[model samples]
Target chain A: MASNSDQQSMDVNYIARLARMNLDALEARQFQTQMDGIVDYVRQLSELDVEGVEPTAHAAPIQNVFREDLAQPGLTQEQALANAPAQSGGQFIVPKIVE
Target chain B: MSAARYEAVIGLEVHVQLKTRSKMFCGCATSFGAEPNTNVCPVCLGYPGTMPVMNREAIRLTVLSGLMLGCRINPRSKFDRKSYFYPDMPKNYQITQYDQPLCLGGGVEIEGASGLATVPLTRIHLEEDVAKNMHFATCSGVDFNRAGSPLMEIVSEPAMHTPEQAVAYLQGLKQTLMYAGVSDCNLEEGNMRCDVNVSLRPVGATALGTKAELKNLNSFKSVLLALRAEIGRQEQLLREGGRVVQETRRWDVEAGATFLMRTKEDAHDYRYFPEPDLMPVVLSEQQIAEWARGLPETPRQRRARFASEYSLPEYDARVLAADKAVGDYFEAAARGSKAPKIVSNWVMTEMLRRLGETGQEIAAVQITPAALAELVELTEAGAINSNTARELFGELFANGGSPRALVEARGLAQVSDSGALQALVDQAIRENAKSAEDFRGGKAVALKFLTGQVMRLSRGKANPQLAAQLLEERLKK
Candidate 1:
């Protein structure tokens, strides 16, 4: 609900940290201005009457569209991991994630 | 303060894999235990330029499940992208229902210690299941066979206070879903999984306390054990004047303890947005009605019917109604016989015992419902004594055959011919003279001894009723 000027003062560094991204000082300033403009555009809708208006989730009017539950041939083991940067023993290898 | 003064608040989120033939959005087969990565497609693998098309059967099943649970199906629902990063999720974002779920506002009734308690449900949403991740000593493997399978996420209100109630609620939910044919709900095969949220508050407090989320609960028994351990841990901390932190805890099955996984601050910020590739689902009144008509009778309705129609005890009806396969089998067998209780007894005792010993499902049992009913009828008509019937049951259980034919082929039919039994009774009276005299001298146990002699002569095939009549008639003379 904050105005565009209020959003401009928002900390871009904190947001970047939450998103796990690193940004330099000039990039942070640039992102802050861009975010402020995006927030301002979304904020304009708040002035309109939303009472009794069901929110729209999709642009199309269709619902319940579905395909039959039929199985078709799919990729082989090699093709499945083809996009992986690292692979070992027919599996995609990533940095170890401790559980 | 004593731990007794504190009560636990519990809610569960259960993820059940629907029994659909294909993947939720692709043509890949949903069969389990297939070769790893064999079921993957470009759509499920999250490759560029791939669009998802919803599976109609999955939608029908979700609606049917909602109807069975007494939920209100939303006229309009759409999928959302829950953005996150996990090795199991190839797309790096899961297509789930965020604000507009398919079903809302339902409750499952569980039998608590006091009586029936209704555990209210918050919502039931449809989503695609992530792939399974397997960990080894040195490396981890991901299987895409389970990915894109139709998964239903059911969230419950924090209405349960004890572990027993939680387990009961789970059992009730599982029974309902199974009856509706929504899912198999098998725990070991990962068809169903549960995450538990629990917190303890003073007995009289109204506001809820900070709750801890327990994950990796594979079975109902594990859910109970994990809750007990988590509740104990919380109580001990509170009793020592410490505050319980709100965090996600991993339940270590081998260690039998809950360990800190992550705090609330470390939770994933799932930037949810509407899935643009798929269309919003709109349901017409006629479509809803059609789906409703196809739903099977609920477990509650079946239990009531079993009691009235079959004349079964309430306990028996409850047990039979808990599983649809068992209930259907009972009905099929009972329909052929007048004595339904007899059929119920066999199913509950001998049939169930055999199933347990052999580790076979009821559907896979050798004895069909009609065959079971025939055995019951033979016993009821006195063609075979109860003892011989039991022995025949063991044979029929081991190797399938008609009871009537088995009785005839094995010479197990009762010797009820009056002329044939008269000779056995005379022989028994001639051999055990002291027993005969004791019977005439008013010793009642001597009559039993004579009956045993008649049974021994006939090799346990003699009709004990006619033998007793013949013995009493000769004793009077």
Candidate 2:
């Protein structure tokens, strides 16, 4: 399993970039090997035949769980911004976004 | 090719914030302009391990809007996670209906230069709006009060050829949504925002040209102006042997031109997947039927009904049917009145003007429809002259009361009795003998002077027509 037989390598660099992660070259190489091993382990599902089965997002067979559209009191401005790393005038401040 | 040979093709994607009392997935108030971040909840704030519970009212209103626009309702719709790294979105990914939106095929019927046409719709999907980001000098502030509000994205097909049709289409969509009571659709208040994609192709070309997306067009005027400028720029570019590039341009309202909004970013690859926490919405036929029963008349249908039921002209019907509240007001005021045209005129002119000047909504006005109807009836029946009726109308519009009662209390009724009118006319002839002499000497202007005297003697209560008739009898002698 460590030697990796005829399977193509996973693009771990692209995946990390999509996740907004900064990986050093060594870390990228290491993650490629580990993620390939993980993918190989997950590929065991290919052995099963799922052609006729209906694709499902939820396995519990439960649907239409909704709450009434009634407003209950939420966090006050003080409580809401309490967790922010930065705050200004009861709002969370960040770097300017765009023009 | 001449500039006229190229036709502009435009399509709009409008985002409307649904008018619900609570957030889409949480029980936070959706009221606008509360203290910043006051409406925040764990679910909308994207706290870890928080699960979203769907708002049944948001779903109902979305389906109702679809029905009002003649869309086919999908029985089963699921939410998908769309990834965006923007800070405006508290969650890294947006929960939107991708392949299974609640509503499928509908069209907005717009009245254009060719009379009436339906701009075909691609789809309408329900999604959650993001937070409000206010950019300051050095830092941007994020307010989560707007997060998780149910927002509807209505995508129109690239079927419009001109900017006029595009504006009409957007107006029609907004009117229908407002009529359904789904969203307020107020452009100025950011209740509705639009993005348009435009391209120009030479006449008789089958394939489309490179399209440019125009953004930040908040108002209908901006939509029209931005589309025009984009179309003009593209046409001029193509005619001058340049190619139209595909990019995103934003409308600079100050400059009245479109400028490149952003540098081309990396290719968007939103790794969309099914949302696992919330379950799919499965509506039964009976449930959809119950909602369909509550669908209000669309703007087009309401306009047609106003024309037929009230016998209003086309222009009046169109103006009256523009707003559902105004149309409701007009209908209630003209329900049993014999003079609907007169009522329509007053509603269109006086009522709308006052509401506009005072920045008030039709529903918040002091005047009641019954009072307006009574006022119109009084003026029509000659119980009060037109001038007196108008004066009383302002009084009634400002201070709500019975028009008849107000007229009686103020002694403003017209003096149409023959005996009282004859006495007033005789007094006018005797006092203004010079004017009477001029009238007998074949001066028609002097006769008008005598009528004014009669009106003044009765304190503007004399019926001018009857007073003129009685004066003619006396002055002839």
Q: How well is candidate 1 docked (DockQ)?
A: 0.50
Q: For candidate 1, what is the recovered fraction of reference interface contacts? A: 0.64
User: Mind giving the per-residue lDDT tens digits that candidate 1 earns over B1-477?
Assistant: 655479999999999999998999999999987777889999888877999999999989998988999999998888999977788886778999998899998999898777677899999999999987777667677777888999999999999999989999999999999999989999878898999999999999988999999998988889999999999999999999899989999999999999999998877777688998989988887999999998999999999999999899998998888878899899999997999999999999898888889988988777788889999999999999988988888888888789989998989999899899999999999999999999999998999999999999999999998999999999998
| Weakest 10 consecutive residues of candidate 2 chain B by summed lDDT | B261-270
Interface RMSD for candidates 1 onward, in order: 3.3, 5.2
**How does each model score on TM-score?**
0.91, 0.88
Q: lDDT tens digits, residues A1-99, model 2?
A: 112234477787777877899999999999999998998898898899999998888889899999998999988888888889999988899998875
In candidate 2, chain A reaches a TM of: 0.85
RMSD of each: 3.1, 4.2
**lDDT for position B99 in model 1:** 88
